[model samples]
Target: TKMDKHNLTVLNEFILMGITDRPELQAPLFGLFLIVYMISVVGNMGIIILTKMDSKLQTPMYFFLRHLAITDLGYSTVVGPKMLVNFVVDENTISYYFCATQLAFFTVFITSELFILSAMSYDRSVAMCNPLLYTVIMSQRTCWMLVAIPYLYRTIVSLLITIKIFNLCFCGYSVIRHFYCDGLPLVSLLCSNTHEIELIILILAAFDFILSLLIVLVSYLLILAAILRMNSAEGRHKAFSTCGSHLTVVVVFYGTLSFMYLQPKSSHSFDTDKMASIFYTLVIPVLNPLIYSLRNKDVKYALHRTLGALCNIFSQSSVYHVFH
Candidate 1:
């Protein structure tokens, strides 16, 4: 009985510590994270607006990009604000309900983004491989459905997972490791048996990452073959150039996500884990718009028009101020 009491006391103390606190580092970390959050916000919002304003970008590629931007916006919002607040608060605390809400929305946006990227790859395959039927196959109806699948599926699955995790009595620890409540990391703090929840995460993550990557790999393989067959050098260059943006976005986005999720949860180092978490959670969203706009000709043209309009608005505002 005395041994049991001693062991329980030690376990409780460890739980309270929960991922070694670095209060001294909080302010510096806050400033760095804030900049990233802002960049992701402006960058994704700008992409969505650019796609809407540019008539020339009315193709399937832009259609998918608009959705990807929407997902990234939602994804960034889910994690960024709470992390900023942690910098100010002494507890760095999160309530059960709030944490659950964050986890749900985070899962929704992330899974949606992956599927959306896969959809974009398929669009590219069609454009590069079956140019004649591109419009017919990637029709308005088809694109909307592709966008809808993840939202619908994730909503149901995330809700169920959230409920399951919450129902498990967490009479254990509350302090989370990372800035936000990532499922696996949070589950590690629970003293109650949580193997079931962990297994679900592993299985679902495998499906989302492995299955999605296989689809993308097959699609891109066919695309590369078709790109190689083009006889004219200019034709081949244009085709490859058109796909460059999506390829860049895919590699970075999936690479970061795989790094974060594909490993055994036990091996995730706190310092490096936080850094890797920041990549998929914060950085990729900001980079996606820049990658697409910088590489794609139509997106570049649209951005110029947007800049002209913004400059006009600023100039007019200045004139009004002077007259007043």
Candidate 2:
């Protein structure tokens, strides 16, 4: 909405009371977001480190799992640190160039993550549905390709879109409500016409969402049928259990995704909108490592061994020092 030839009128300034403006709120919010961000970093990075260190974890499945952890870290790095600093800083303003950079990274990593998750589901499906063929089909070469596809694809697409968005002239309404450079919301502020870009975005989002969803759906459907065919109830139960948590993660990812981008852009709600952002941006990355690691016995053993070894080393050093 243009207010004047020289100015772009903000219809809703969803004023995010930055730390400098609300001195009373700064301490509390800063402490809160900081803790959440740290937990996300630790949980995701723990998976990455554990997967790399444990020889038993060096399978195609864990290979993708490590990439998934990497993506979550990528996701958090884009949103978390910036918001944390903003909570305590005097001025919360990010420059146009920095904002654009943030926007590009956010899009690239998110698209990559979604693609990786979809590939993971397919991997699980193949393993469960056709155990004999899993190794032959999901070979090292194939697994590596699955990882590389998203990184390359999203890098190209996001770069193109970011260039399109930032090239448009701004009409002076520069305050972004929620933290980060949300592509559509940020694009809405342009002085030039943005309908073309939005349609392109809609097409791009639809491509990412539907393609990933289709792969996931197909994978699960096959897995479910295979699980049902298992002769013993216990066998079936174990098979389904392996994928259940991953399925949960996928549902949450797509559900929040549909709310954020699937809905007509015309119907914008600030509070609900922010909530949807939380789904992919903050919550998904944090939940993924926990979900994959929690019930799986192997992951637990690996983590336990890693911690136990560290403790034993400390105890041995103490004994050596006492003798000395």
Candidate 3:
């Protein structure tokens, strides 16, 4: 154990070869991602603020949505700034402990998000299938539990995996091919046999993926059945509208993730993986708030109400200052 611990410190740091290696492309790419990161931060933050401020949004759907926005903001914050810095700098180095920390937090947020989406799906199913008992079934206490369990579960899982990955002996070469310190990329750098670590990553990823996806699939199926049985065209249309934004989000998030992680190892390319990672890490966060705000009339109304209230407050303050 002592020797293994000693060996772990052999590689003091890792150099992150970012999204692109082309000399000319770095600055333009940097500018592009800067805009993306800004949009993501603003969009997710707006969702969070709107959900908190609007009485109309004080429902289970918005409750789940608020957490989803938090996670989108969390993981993006973890990866975006550092990657942006790397884009402009000469040496894209991350220290041993810092890399481990990045991996851990990234894992927690990403995994928690996966389960949260599933929870949202289940919430939708209840709303559609058992409208009478929806409130009773998804009470404030229940919503808190649904959100809490995922964060706790993912924290423990991230801790164990981070410890396991860092415990392995890395060869002299400490260059990671991806933008962020991802598990598989780190595992690939090990001088020791990587079979066990690789297996652990694969098993955990597969399990999380399948389990959460099953929840979503089953939930949507129930919603579909409920929708089909509706006697009125208006009711059916309303049901579809209620589920549309969430369904779109689920499809985009899961589709990018599945393409990135579910493929055979033989087909794995770091470049291709980087593209998929960008879609989720940067693109999805921007897309989510836009998707929800644009699709849901409730959110749009909340935004207008919130802006009106702010404007009134500003005008009143200006008038007071002018008189003083």
Candidate 4:
């Protein structure tokens, strides 16, 4: 038991070398990320609330969007608070177990978001290509199944990956070069052979990217064909408009992800990786809700109506107070 405890203490914690070590940059970066995190949380929460409360947003598309917001919120919260703390703290250290937990949750949410986007694309395709049977095809039961599968699948995958990574022998070196505990950075710290784990990470990353991207591409192709077949100019425009927000989101998400993880190892720079990670993990979450809400008329309308209703309630309460 004493020997076991000694071994555990040896790998007790990790120093997270955050975005920058410059004293001058710390406060500014903290302020910037703080604002970014706040907006991300509020925006994603607004999307979830709007989808839930607005009958107009009760369709299958909004259902997927609600889950997307949730995953965005999930991963952002997992990383953001710890990161902000690291900026100001004398030591940006995370405990061994805490790092593993962060990696696990980050993996789960990021992977789930990818598949959820794929599901959303499929929803768009069904709505556009098979308008007549859209409701029947994307029924409530079917919608729930699509989202449930990703969450369940990713949870298992993340746990396995986390367990495998943590099981490696981390000795002497404990400073993670990046802001958070990412797979590659952790792998690099292992004094033991990293070949098998490297291969596994590479395979999993490739599989996730290719599979999800393929779904999005095929769905868009189908949607494109359906749009061309429509005789009405207005109909084509409406179809394209409905698809635009989702397309923008997919492009930004996948593009940044591919650039970050799919690069050759020789070309990898921790600084560059940190920037890319910041974009997807923090910036994108804030962008998704804006992209969806501002671009989609239905979402915009629902937001206005919701705001209007709240205003009415507040105004009525004020009048009642004045009378009393």
Candidate 5:
């Protein structure tokens, strides 16, 4: 038994029970998650590259979008690959140190994504409500600051949470039912009293959720009001078109997250929690790039332009090779 400074025994590693132990389910689960992971990485990477290459997309909206894509890519990569490995491998064990690291990074990116969404909502509000002032208000420096603030804040908070939680002594139970080292799952495994930790988490989570929701809600309300004031039908359609994709993403992301975290701890069900985690972890990341690219004409145009240029370059290379 490993003794801590408090003389409490701690575990060195944990066996993840994952979604299911059934042999029949393993193969199908692996295949499904593999497809989702691939799409997430490719789609998010495409968005980042497209945004960078297309000067037209250098606005505040796409600035947040680029960071959001990066965060989604990071978040999905942090969680998906480990889970994928677990599905294929016979032993689904994770070192204590690695689990803590996963939780920290997961917290950072997930929180960053939430804040990025809030920033996007604010950008939409400004664009719709004060079109003439949008450029002045969302200057390049301002946009970079907005993106940087979330990463800074979330990183600090995640570190505190990680340190505090890991300090708690884990009892004899080393099996975490969930695939990843989630906050609640880790809390549940602790042998010591978790009242203080639970309270801290609840307060932090509520504040984060409430703040982001308010920003999104208030921004959209003003956006709606602005849309109603528009004289031209085309103008109103354009405003709605720009905001629709973001609103859809916010709903899906917050819906899954709220369902996962907002409930009473006593009512926590591992099976249901795992399902909710899958939506945000696997489904939302894949859907985000699709929603933005498919709905926004700018992104579609940028993608087409980039691909066309690449094809032209390839064709020229082929012709040169033939001549040589």
Candidate 6:
């Protein structure tokens, strides 16, 4: 046990080779990522704020949406800034503890997103299939529990995976071939056999993925059946409108993640994997707010109201200053 601890202590720092090494690409890449990150933060934050200020949005759907926005904000924030800094800087060195921390938080947030999306799907299903009982079934207490379960499950799973990975000796190489600390890159550096750890990660990831996927699948299937049963065309259209944005986000998010993690590890390509990572880590966060706001009329109305109120406040402040 003492000897194992000593091995892990020897590897204190790891150098990260980011998405690109070309000096010419660095400036453009930095600017692009910076802009994307800013937009993502503002947009997701706006969603959360709109939900809070508008009573019309005080429903289970919006409740789940607010958390989804928060999760996207956090997920991107965890990785984007680090990637931007690494893009501009020379040495992208991260301490073992720091790497572990990044992996831990990233794990929690990413897995949380999956579970939250699943919960949102269930919410949509209830609204469609059992419209009369939707509010009672998805009460405030139930909504809180839906939000809580994912974070609790992922945090515990991440802790176990992190502990297991850190125990193995990283003797050969100290360089990770990615912008941030990810499991596969870190595992590649291990001097010991990683079959056990890989198997553990695979199982955990599968459980998270499959469990959430089943929920989404089942929810949408029920939702589709309900829509088919509706006699009026307008009734079916109204039902689909409520879930269109969520379904779009679900497709994009799950599509990328399934491509990334669900396949055999032997199929992985570092460069290709990094590109896929960018979509989820950078592109998706920016897309989420745009997707939700653009598709949902209620969110657009809320945003307009929020912006109009801010303008009025500013106009009042200006008048007061002039009089003073």
lDDT of each: 0.80, 0.82, 0.94, 0.93, 0.91, 0.90
132-248, model 3: which lDDT tens digit per residue?
999999999999999999899899999999999998788777889999999988987887788988888889899999999999999999999999999999999999999999999
For candidate 1, the lDDT comes to: 0.80
Instruction: Put down candidate 4 lDDT per residue, 109-216, tens digits, no spaces.
Output: 998999999999999999988889999999999999999988998899899889998997886678899999999999988867789999988888889889999999
Considering summed lDDT, which 10 consecutive residues are worst modelled in model 4? 1-10
TM-score of each: 0.88, 0.92, 0.97, 0.96, 0.96, 0.95
Steric collisions counted per model = 0, 0, 0, 0, 0, 0
Off by over 4 Å in 5: 1-9
* Candidate 1 local lDDT, 157-258, one digit each (tens): 888888877666553445566778778766766555788988898788788887778878988999999988989999988888888888899999888877
Question: Which of the two, 3 or 5, has more TM-score?
Answer: 3
RMSD of each: 3.9, 3.2, 2.8, 3.1, 2.3, 2.8
**Which scores better on lDDT, 4 or 5?**
4
> Which model, 2 or 6, shows the larger TM-score?
6
Candidate 2: tens digits of C-alpha lDDT, residues 1-324:
444656654333222333245578778878877877788899989999999999889898889889988988997898888877887666576766777788899998888888888998999999997799989999999999998988999999999999998777765666666767788778767778889998888899889889988999899899988888889999988887888878888888888888877666578765577777866787788888889899677899999999999999999999999999
Report how far residue 241 has shifted in candidate 5, in Å: 0.9
Encode model 6's per-residue lDDT on 189-299: one tens digit a residue.
887889999998888888888999999999999999999999999999999988899999999999999888766768888888999999999999899899999999999
Better of 2 and 3 by lDDT: 3
Q: Which stretches of candidate 2 lie over 4 Å from their true place?
A: 1-3, 7-26
Model 1, position 272, has a per-residue lDDT of 73
